[model samples]
Target: MDIGILLLGVAVLIGAVVVSATGGDRKIARLDRRLARVEQKLDAIAANLGVDLPEPELATVKALLAEGKKIQAVRAYREATGADLKEAADAVERLGG
Candidate 1:
């Protein structure tokens, strides 16, 4: 009886781990998609604005977009240009090129 209980406990623990891991993976995937969408928007904005940024900062912004951190990316761009969200996103869109 004791051995059966121990086995059951282990099985439960394994199940819990799997569930948590799957949940985390799903969240990460959702975030990735969101970032991609946001990046596309920024790229469009940048192209319309006809602006360019250094490759390094542009790369960082791209990574931030992929990570679903648009607000952060916008803030960074705003700091550099003293621009608001719309302007900053537009600048980013141009930079995406």
Candidate 2:
């Protein structure tokens, strides 16, 4: 029946969308790994050149830390720097200390 064919078409379309989304996720993961490697290399180069990378100055984050709002500081750092949660938390802790 036509209904069966329509159902099959819809199923195929859904499958295609899922496949594409999965592929995109894999590509993003690969890119993230590549970017991390590049960052490592850049850090090494900077170290060899005796270049001290200046820490980013985030006034809001600093103020939050000073006020004993550690969680807010971490969240602000992550928002400003696009860093992961763990990285933001660690950075906030260091700044607080």
Candidate 3:
């Protein structure tokens, strides 16, 4: 009888582990999809702008934009490219900035 109970407990533990793993996988998948979408948008923004932004610059600009740092974005663009303010703004506007 104890042997049967032990087997049943092991089965239940295995089932619970499987269920938990499946749930974790689902959450990871959703996070991956969300990340993919954000990456696509970033790519689109980069493409729309004529400038070829490096990965670091792109990431920084994304963070700046998220923080509502429009002026900072323009300034950073100018500083990075040594472009004038007008040119920087133009590039940003082209990118839907």
For all candidates in order, the CA lDDT equals 0.80, 0.92, 0.80
Model 1 residue 93 CA deviation in Å: 28
lDDT of 3 at 65: 65
What's every prediction's RMSD, in angstroms?
11.4, 4.7, 13.5
- After superposition of all CA atoms, the RMSD between model 3 and the true structure is 13.5
Better of 1 and 3 by TM-score: 1
User: Candidate 1, 44: how far from true, in Å?
Assistant: 0.6
lDDT of 1 by residue, 1-97 (tens): 9999999999999999999999999999999999999999998999889966554345566677778787777777777667888988887777552
Residues 1-97, candidate 3, lDDT per residue (tens digit)? Answer: 9999999999999999999999999999999999999999988998899658664355555567678887888887777677898988887666557
> Which runs in model 3 stand beyond 4 Å of their true positions?
54-97
What residue pairs are clashing in model 3?
A: none
Which sequence of candidate numbers ranks them by TM-score, best first? 2, 1, 3
What is the overall TM-score of model 2 with all chains considered together? 0.66
Better of 2 and 3 by lDDT: 2
Q: What would the per-residue lDDT of candidate 2 be over residues 1-97, giving only the tens digit for each residue?
A: 9999999999999999999999999999999999999999999999999999777679999999889998889989999888999999998888872
Where does model 2 exceed 4 Å of error? 64-97
